[model samples]
Target: MTVSTDPGEAATAAPPVNGNAPGRGHRGPVWLALTLALGLLLGIGVGLVIPQFLKPGDTSPEAGFLRDMSTHHAQAVEMSMIAHSASTTPEIISLSSDIALTQHAQIGYMQAWLRDWNLSPTSSQEPMAWMPDAEGSIVNGLMPGMATPEQMTALRAMTGKPLDVEFLTLMRQHHLGGIHMAQEILKLSDDKNVTWLAGTMVTAQQGEINLIDMLLKKLQTA
Candidate 1:
């Protein structure tokens, strides 16, 4: 058995035996102009007119997405932090670091939105309430792509190739679920900032997913 030299290993190592686991677009300046125009219109509607027409309450889709995605991003940051500290491979460590930092920033962005909206970071409703029929394959409450406690424990215990593979697997799934949530929001929301962020997430996460899948195959051969 290969022992892990990961400095963070001890912190993640506890408990055992559980189960497991865990868009692109183009358009030139003309398209960009149209999209931006649409976004401005939506923003104005949300800021000025929409409040009078239909205010988003605590149970609104935006609130639910903010709350749930914050939680979801938290786990990714945690796992990626572990991988960043534990993995022997430089590529894996770098990838994990990028994942951790990017998601960490996103979490902050969402939380700031919550505060700016005068909403609580958490909600009384369930996690996936915003997208009731979105996707059924979720863990714990209803957050998709989250690793169970046991899987996390296992990840903490693993090292080397196993650790890299496991991280890729979990992170890939996590990204997929996040993309799903983002896409769902794009469909349900007309708020310019909200939709723009969601659209950005879909694009970024999909690129990462492709990179992770490629790395997974490369690591499998090593």
Candidate 2:
């Protein structure tokens, strides 16, 4: 096995198992704007709005969650970019592209939340404080769905079919990790947009996992 050299690795916070949000919540008309903005952020496809609203504070769980999740999603987007270029299968390439596009937009959404809150993009606290049990090998300091440095290095070295398989496998793990985080946020969060997006993440990533599994099986047979 190759070695992993991620600083977040030893810290044991991992982005959030699901994905993380970047900032806390805000009060007043900010809620309306945030709700509308997030809808636009998620776009028409998964931009289903909820009726409830979130509370505001510099360190609110909702804001931190959004900020952290957005950062997590950014890494996923980066990984997807790699897979899009290197995958041998058109299906895999398409799937990777979709992930990149969706998560990149969502990252923008979370960043907007931070700006609305007048909060910094990063937290002074250790990673995954919002998630207490997130102290495991894969559960690094900040990015829950993140792959290790060695995994990234291996992927960079691969070109064709091997690249396809490895990419699918690692991405599957990443999505699964993300799904775990999303499920947690869904249970704990009450903010309309945040909860809705977290739940949607579960649904979308699960379907992708199924598709990825099927792809992997077929590739293995081939």
What overall lDDT goes with each candidate model? 0.84, 0.76
- Report the C-alpha lDDT of model 1 over 1-222, residue by residue, as the tens digit: 888888579436742335321112343557889999999999987798656445456788988888888998999999999899899898889899998998899888889887877789997776788986854745556477888889999999998889999999999999999998999988888877778888988998999999998899898887
* Clash pairs detected, candidate 1: none
- TM-score, one value per model: 0.74, 0.71
lDDT score of residue 12 within candidate 1:
67
lDDT of 1 at 158: 92
Per-residue alpha-carbon lDDT of candidate 2 for residues 1-222, written as tens digits (9 for 90 to 100):
665788777446445433443343335468888899888877754433331123445566667677667777877887888989876679989999999998888788778867766678888855555655766623445366578788888888888788889888888888877787777777777777778888888899899999989999988998
Worst 10 residues of 1 by lDDT: 15-24
Cα lDDT for residue 2, candidate 2: 67
lDDT of 2 at 43: 78
Alpha-carbon RMSD of each model: 30.6, 26.2
Give the residue spans of candidate 1 off by over 4 A: 1-55, 134-137
